[model samples]
Target: MRDGVRPPLRNHHEEAAEELGTTTKRDTINTALREVTARYRRLRALEEAREPAADGALDMDLLLDKRAYRPRGADSATDDHGTGADG
Candidate 1:
C-alpha cells in the first residue's frame, strides 16, 4: 500500500520480473532469488535420490566407435597409400 516501499511479488519470477520491469527494487529481487534457489535445491535432491551414484548419474547415453577411435595405420608400420614402409 505504501508508495516508497515495495510489496512482495507472487511466486513466479518471470511474471514478477515482467510486472516489476527494469526498475525492480532489491527486496523484490532478493525474494525471487530465494524462491528460485529453494526450488533448485529441491529438484537437485530429487535427482540425487533417483541416481544412487555419488556423481548423480544413471543410464547415460554414450556413443563410441572403436574402429574410428583407433586408426588402421596403428596396426602396422605400412601407410595407407603406396609409400614404402622403409621410406
Candidate 2:
C-alpha cells in the first residue's frame, strides 16, 4: 500500500515481453543461455583446479562449452563495417 507501488504477480516475463514487443520464449532462451555459459566457465575452472589423488592426473574438460551465439575473436576476424553484427 504505497503511493505508486503495485503487488507482485506471476509470469512477469509475458507482461514484459508484451510491453517490449517480443516473445517470452526468446527472453527465456537468452537468460538460460547466459546462465549456462557462466556456469560452464565456472565449473570448468573448478574442475581444472582440483588435484588428483594419484598419479593418474589428467586435464579436466571442466565442462566448458563454446557459446553458440558468441562471435569470433577480435584478432581472428576482420570487421570492415565497424559493427560486430557480421560476426
Worst 10 residues of 2 by lDDT: 53-62
lDDT of 1 at 10: 47
Model 1 alpha-carbon drift over 4 Å, by segment: 1-14, 17-24, 53-87
What is the per-residue lDDT of model 1 for residues 20-83, given as tens digits with 9 covering 90 to 100?
A: 4633556568766788899999999978766764464543332235554454664243454446
Model 1 accuracy (lDDT, Cα): 0.61
The models' CA-based lDDT, in order, is 0.61, 0.61
Every candidate's CA RMSD:
12.0, 12.2
Q: Looking at candidate 1, what is the lDDT of residue 44? A: 96
Instruction: Tell me how far the alpha carbon of residue 36 in candidate 1 is from the true structure, in angstroms, after superposition.
Output: 0.9
Residue 57 of candidate 1: its Cα lDDT?
54
Scored against the true structure, residue 5 in model 1 reaches a CA lDDT of: 64
- Per-candidate total of colliding backbone pairs: 0, 0
